[model samples]
Target: MTPDHPKSRRSFSDFLLHLHPRTIPEENLRLTLSWGLGGMAVMLVCLLFLTGILLLLTYQPSTGSAYASIVTLTREVRFGLWIRNIHHWSANLLVVIAMLHLLRIVLTGAFGQGRRLNWIIGLFLLFLLLSANFTGYLLPWDQLAYWAVTICTSMLGYIPVGGLWLQELFRGGAEIGPATLSNFCVLHVAFIPATLFVLLLWHFWLVRRAGGLVQVEHDNPDDVPVQRVPTVPNLIVREAAVGLVLVAFILILAIVWDAPLMEQANPGMSPNPAKAPWYFLGFQELLLHLHPVFASFLWPLLGVAALLWVPFWQDSALPTGVWFGSNSGRRLVIWTATVGALTTLAIILADNLLLQSNAAVAVDTLVTRGLLPTALLIALLVGFYFLLVKGLKYTRAEAVMAGIVLVLVALAVCTIIGVWFRGAEMHLVWL
Candidate 1:
């Protein structure tokens, strides 16, 4: 059919249909496939952008006016509360969806094959999304936003040599003032969004070029290639449905809970036990138990480097894109995850109980916060490395997956502690 046809003009769905293939295999759209996470992330991104634009109309980025503007917008502007709330919730959900999307890829071993480069791209996008959240959250300049940014940037300044310079770059000075707010506002609304859009399109193009989705359930390698369908009616409609549900879910959240806005920022007084945003709480939790250098910089950089190098190490016997790479890989994942979780829990529990019980293990002292935990973490990884190499006799790919699983579990445990179990002064406090 031509563009001028009456059918084409019926609704905006026609234009959207062009973006997807006409049909996909009926099995590909199964809820078990991808869990609709990638689609949900995209939908949330679009929702955030739409609502952000609306919120921007009334928001002023100046430190003096930012909080007041938010108050005005919520109170006086029509549906301003709803729009900002939608943007807020979508931003939160987008982070979660991105993480889950990556988790799915890792679990399915979909990051192997030619999908390796795309995996790196996805990692970059994750950080970009995180940066988006960090910059955007400070716009309100409330006590929560203010103190959170302050603690974070201060922690950054604790990095050894260039830390101060990096922190200064973000702060625009010694403090989070008008200049800092303006810079963050510009980056949040303009540069980051633009770059993310370009990267997202590039990512999709690569996904298509690399072969759409991994056929995880296929049993025979010699069978005829699966017939594909147009993505429009099959995949596109499903995405639309997911988008509607996501929007409705967020709408309900917005109605029941307003986005938090504490009193305007006070430069003279920092909140007791000021916290970082929920996402960074995990790192904050780790920071409290490890040396600043390890907590804030070296450890994170090493993890990234390790992940970046995974695809280069290979075992010909292991086929790529198969879950855990094989049955042996599954065993490795389970063992590593269990070890990691238990080790992580034990370290945190020990620290909370003994950091004060013995003078030798005093909190903030080198032995308690620096030497011990760092050594333990290193030992855990090294032990897992040798375990996979010797006991399991796993391939390099499987070893890598095991290591990834261990790290993910440990980080997740730390995040849980930071988000839920810590209270004033970073002391352990059960919910």
Candidate 2:
């Protein structure tokens, strides 16, 4: 017997239809606008989710068996290696695509004014993605995964108060062990994915609600708006095409690189230069130059807070929806960003050179680590604000774009240095 009749029952097809609008403006279909980064990222998410589910069938999260299970999955099970590699690569790629997607939003002024809440949601997603990645990194039960996670969790112990407790709460003990693995395994496979699904739904809905991408005429910024096309075939087909290319790229990497799985974790034998995961190497590298508090937490926290506050603090009413607003806006962003990059690099260089020899121990550490570097950053941003306001006469939205570019450049430089330039003992080795 069939179930009781329902009013307008929600079928699978109906749910698919409800996902996006039947039609979107033709202008919203511009590939050059958003670069399909968000769509590709979403596809990566789905790919990883499926592969991860398959892996879960045979993988054991227990400490004693975790390493053995992963080994069995990679070497014993049929096509298990391919599935694991794809899942691993897709997880890494998702973070990169998400960062690129965020950059697109910043450059295009997509998070301006009325979109403040979406910006916050995006930040939360970023945090969750990073958290998920961190938790997943430990699942392999290998040397790289073990040491990297140990270092990452230990960083939290440096927090002023209740920090150690928080660290232990996640660690499941005073140290990284079986309980810690169990906690992360649950968080990685369960909590993060569930939270991500909810946020993704909200993100997509907001995109549709916000009327899709902002229409911008390159030759004429002030020109009237363009028409939108249906999201079904036009937008959907294009996204699928881009997604196919992305999948091919990931598959090729999985074939060529096969996810690195070192010997099972040896807490006794620490790898030399035991680096954090590549995504976090930037923060670890900064620890070489700055105080732990600043490098590990405060500095990055400040950057995130600034991004969260930008939409709220900057002029919300200012005309947005265009990439860099006006032509003048583009020039302003370029010049300010260039200055900010150079300024940060110069400060870093000076601290390494001049401040290293300073006999005033307390003063040298403070200057090189925290106070002076921060003061310079503040001054640079202030200078940028004046230049945007007085020199270029920029609207608030335009200035915020420039500011974001500067921050992105600084962070990128640090990441590049950390990942490629640092040598044994975290020394700056020219690569």
Candidate 3:
């Protein structure tokens, strides 16, 4: 066991080899199974780190010079704009890919059989990924970044208690200022990335320990022997191919689309319809129709809690490792999505009409805008759940899947409205 012994002197490749099992199920190699999302996500994170470091070479975090530095980086430095574009696009794409990866896990029941810890870790990773994006959003010190951050931080004050304290903690005072930018820079560059790196390592290790991706369970397990392939060439080759394609796609996108940069921040002159980042647009859209507490605090909290609860809700009737749990589950998803979208549209239209006609003014704001909508949403979900379970004879798991899909569809619709439909004074505009 001497330090210089051949056995002790493992190469970098050897270390990497040890990170994965000697053999993994051959089925895991199928691209359609996992959709290569997890691998794509890993590639995106690597790109983010690489490009972020390059951008840091010129990015000035100070309020006075941040915007100017960005301008110089994009216009003056060689390949600076491309690097920034890659970082921007990669961050946004990572958010999306991470979410889809989570959804794949849920639909395939990959979180079952003592994998709950990894599921929780995955959820935290998603949250941290979002935090990373939010912190980075402010570094340019542009109007878009400043007001968007302001609106998001202001929403924090809607919490039941200690809301103002939380708001100040993020804002660094009563408003977005010098301290806020410095704090976010430290978080984005030092704390958040460091934490994400550690968590990502842990996540990968857990996946490896769990014997790679979950395989589809056959009805008669003993009838056929499970086939496994060596991890070195089989899994590694597929991963390498995916990484190459992903890198090429990202580079092309970065070249084609430059990251947006608005004028330097002028806090005194807010935009006509200042909005949060697109991810949070669902919440902003909710605020327009509901009370702040429900939109900003309660509904989001509930959604997250439901996600956290997913792994614990076990049903023997539902098959594991199958898309949407079963054929019936797939139909449930379709029905839920269609009904959810139409219902959301109807509600929005009705609410808009009420406001325009001044009919909503007669009721208390809390009742008309907050409690009623919240109660209605709950009732609809609960009623739909029962209908699926009792009337349709679906398993509880399928019912839960329906509920989640419905809520997600509603949120997606709201986000679309917020991003494309909202105009001056946050009013709905067809264009």
Candidate 4:
């Protein structure tokens, strides 16, 4: 048969459909459900891969030549700056999309039942995405990259037992140098990308196996059967449209705003208020108010542990596929978010005031600065849980959700402050 024949077209369509289910629930097609964040992530990853290959053609991943090579590429090579900008912006956008996808899964109770493993896989993918971005950040070999990475690696040293070892492992020495550049280049271009690709495939397969996107349940037996649509034309077309829009958006952004590149890496000089990447700025903000061990190691570890525990703690009675699990869950989120933001801002302001006054000297020790703050956070969370369960009559699942939302709100507030408000000497300065 000729390429344009019906038989040929049908066979080609079948080939495309093989990657997806022949029929998917109509609910899965709703953009409002998943917000197409997962599809956007996949599209961003594809963009990153394409732009990264273009970049690798000229990028010199070495302490001696990296910055000069990037400058030459940006100024001399055809479309080199645009390609680099796309890659840079796409990588950052992937981080945000991955996080939002994860949050969607949690809030909608998509991790319930057999999907727990997929949830864990999603978490790992997020971690790998962050790793990819972090390693790539050092590839530019500019002063901004150098000191930002130095600050982040230094945080790793705050871990109790293997902290210093881990820091040295990544830094390739006691500090960021030639060896560190080489190590990051390899991980960024080869190891991390390869691992992330494999995990992404596994994540997709698991989601398909779990029966597509989760859907709202029907309690009445007489309810009409749920609608279904073919994946080849329906789902694929929607995805393609979304992908094109995302590409257009990123391309416009790439043209409008060039990716930042500062002076060459200088060991002799450090930028005052040298900060970590925007993603890690939340932790950097935390470090200002708490002990390094608590801010850098313990609290982060606990947060991850809490996320991992979410699936197991999920209440079976809570309906899956509904936003916030129920109306109670929605109310809990609203209340938690308001209280959490106010409390976080209050604490930051109070702490800053104390630091500016003689009172800070009295609270400078580990107990007052570290353990006390840690205990207070725990107390607040526990207290909030009880209040929700007892006073508000929320279910256990809703209470867990409240805690998660509160923590997210607090982190967001901290990140915003770190990125925009903090100025010289890490002092809070309204911009």
lDDT of each: 0.80, 0.81, 0.87, 0.88
Candidate 2, which ten residues in sequence have the lowest lDDT sum? 1-10
Return the TM-score for each candidate structure: 0.91, 0.90, 0.95, 0.96
How do the residues 1-431 of candidate 3 rate in per-residue lDDT, one tens digit apiece? 67777675555337767778878898889887788999999999999999999999999889999999999999999999999999999999998899889778867777777578899999999999999999999999999999999999989999989999999998888889999999999999999999999999999999888888888788798987789888877888899899899899989999999999999999999988999999999899888878888889989998999888877877622356678987778887887899899989888888888877884364227776778878987898789878888998988878877777788889999999999999998989998
**Candidate 4 per-residue lDDT over residues 1-431, each given as its tens digit:** 68899999998888767557789998889888898899999999999989999999999888999999999999999999999999999999998898889778878878878888998899899999999999999999999999999999999998999999999999999989999999999999999999989998898888889889888888873685878898988999999999999999999999999999999999999998898999999999998888789899989998999888878874822466789887767876887789899989998998899888864364336898889888988898889888878987888877877787789889999999999999999999987
* The 10-residue segment with the lowest total lDDT in model 4: 357-366
> Whose TM-score is greatest here?
4
Report the candidate with higher TM-score, 3 versus 4: 4
Error of 4 at 222 (Å): 5.9
Model 1 lDDT per residue over 221-329, tens place: 4585667776756777777788899889999999888888999999888887788999988889878767777787767877889777776566422353365667767
- Arrange candidates by TM-score, descending: 4, 3, 1, 2
Error of model 4, residue 343, in angstroms? 1.5
Residue pairs with backbone overlap in model 1: 21-230, 21-231, 21-232, 22-230, 22-231, 23-229, 23-230, 23-231, 24-229
The clash count of every prediction, one per candidate, is 9, 8, 0, 0
Global Cα lDDT for candidate 2 = 0.81
RMSD of each: 2.9, 4.1, 3.1, 1.8
Which residue segments of model 4 deviate by more than 4 Å? 1-12, 314-318, 359-364
Which wins on lDDT, candidate 2 or candidate 4?
4
Candidate 3 regions exceeding 4 Å error are: 1-12, 316-318, 359-364
lDDT for residue 151 in candidate 3, whole number 0-100: 93
The TM-score obtained by model 4 is 0.96
